[model samples]
Target: MEKKKVLLLGGAGFIGLNITKFLSENRDYTITVADNFSRGKKDEYLIKLLENPAISMIEGDFTVPATYDQLEKDYDYVYMLASVVGVNNTLEIPHEIIRINTALIYNTLEWLKASFVKKVLFTSTSECYAGTIDAFGYKVPTPETIPLTIEDIGHPRFTYAVTKMLGESGFLNYSRKCGFECTIVRYHNVFGPRMGFKHVIPHLAQRFLANETPFLVYGHDQTRSFCYITDAVEGTVLAMENERSNGEIFHIGTMDEITIEELIREAGNFFGYKGEYENAPTYPGSVARRCPDITKAKNMLQFEPKINWKDGLKLTLGWYKAFFESGKESFEKAFEKPKANV
Candidate 1:
């Protein structure tokens, strides 16, 4: 049997990397991981994956049109996971976020118009509908049918969400006209090992390691549903492979909602921190609560998340602990203080 040709744009990142591994291990596909190594470096995990004859890597700044020339015209599957994410980047360099994310989405859409790709899965985030929850008080355990709203267009933090909204619209509309299948998956609080330091989990790991006394629980009341990486990858694959998913959007996350205080205390417990805890102001424009309704994904794709938040948290905290204890520094800028949880 011939293997399917699979292309993962920005496949070296946290979720993308795991998706690649999952496919390589379970499915018969010749995988090509295209990335610029901006955030997803040539890490040991990525390097090890590349050692597999079934997997290959392509390095390029995909924002440029010429980079698309490096790819084959025909592929059985294309996972468009490329984007500029993180609340830190949005707050610090909103313009760059717009530039890079817009360019990547637009270029990919144009390329897909002419390519012979069978199906494409565009990864999105729960941040896209955060404004709906904040402004309109949309129901918690939000469903994919909820309207996507931006509270403040001028706010720097919404820049990431804005670009994602563009990708969602662009891919869905383009697939209708361009003759390729497309599905969108909006991830909610997906966390696990190798998810980078800019997120909440890794930051908590770092602060606990520093032995900060009187630990501040930012957004102690804000609630979120954390989905483990493995479960997220499974949901994504099901979305792409399931025929009924075409032209449909799925919320790929868990429904287990917990408070920020609970999350922070869990991390504290993991590190054996016997110290005082205080409530502190979280980053600006952060959501008060977020949890995705996965009924659509469950019904259409039979998606089921097996890892509970507590177990997933332990796995993530353990990875960060080992990484930090090894005296290794992050290749990207260290997020010293807590920013808007992304």
Candidate 2:
């Protein structure tokens, strides 16, 4: 059989880059990455991927329909992983988050509808299920059946949730109306090597490594279901291959829950740092707890996370050490300052 072709929007980011690497290793897909480098360029990863004859790179914004059109030819799968990410950054620029996320979904769906793409996967976030965990608790995972009504998302952090909800709904609607396969993966806190340090894992890693004083903890009681990059990418690829996933949403994360305090302690342990954590003012739009119900994912796609929290933390710290030692100014910049609103 001929290899399938895949176009990955935002392919230069953490999750996208890992997905590209995983897919390329199979030597069974022609992968083209299109990224605007809004966060920063992954020139090193891009360069390494380019070494593979099957991979191609394109620099463009997902908000542009013409950009999608440029790479729309003869593709079996289209994955839209583009968005203004990081909780702080999203809250600081909610308007851009809403516009870019919505536009990317709309444009990608519109283009795929007109073209012959076989399957399109829209990367949504666990943020969409924000307050659901508050009601459901860790014992009860948030299932996809839960309605995404306004009442379910009654929090300021809902800006990201609401926009992502719109993106998922838009993709499903367009897929149904236009006759294309669509899959939605609501990712939780996916941490791993190459993850932007702006995120919790790498952020903590950097602080621990730097022996920074008064490590900051925002909303110490809040908890989240963390997923490793390998698990996230595996679940996503499985969703793409499983025909049952079309027009469905799956929570791609480990069901285990960890609090901010616990995460800080564990990360400190991973880095062998003994820094004291100080309580910081909670940012706007922060959720108290966010965990997913993976029953649907397991029953439907046989998806189970292989890496537990401790192991994942170790692997991430190793990556952070290498990243720090590489003396890449861009990597260092990732740890400079936290956004006011994350």
In terms of lDDT, which candidate is strongest? 1
lDDT of 1 by residue, 133-187 (tens): 9999999989999999988999898999999999999999999999999999999
Top model number, TM-score = 1
Per residue, candidate 2 scores C-alpha lDDT tens digits across 1-342 of 898899888888888888899999864888999989886476777789889989998998879887875685668888888887767655467677778878877787778778888888999886665555544543346777765544334444456777788888888888888878899998888888877767777777667777877777766777777898899999999999899998899988988987777887887777776667887765555667677889999999999899998898889888888877788664434655642222
lDDT for 204 (candidate 2)? 72
In candidate 1, stretches whose alpha carbon ends up further than 4 angstroms from where it belongs are none
How well does candidate 1 match the true structure in TM-score terms? 0.98
* Total backbone clashes of candidate 1, pairs 3 or more residues apart or in separate chains: 0
- The 0-to-1 C-alpha lDDT of every candidate, in the order given, reads 0.93, 0.78
Please give the lDDT score at residue 188 for candidate 1: 91
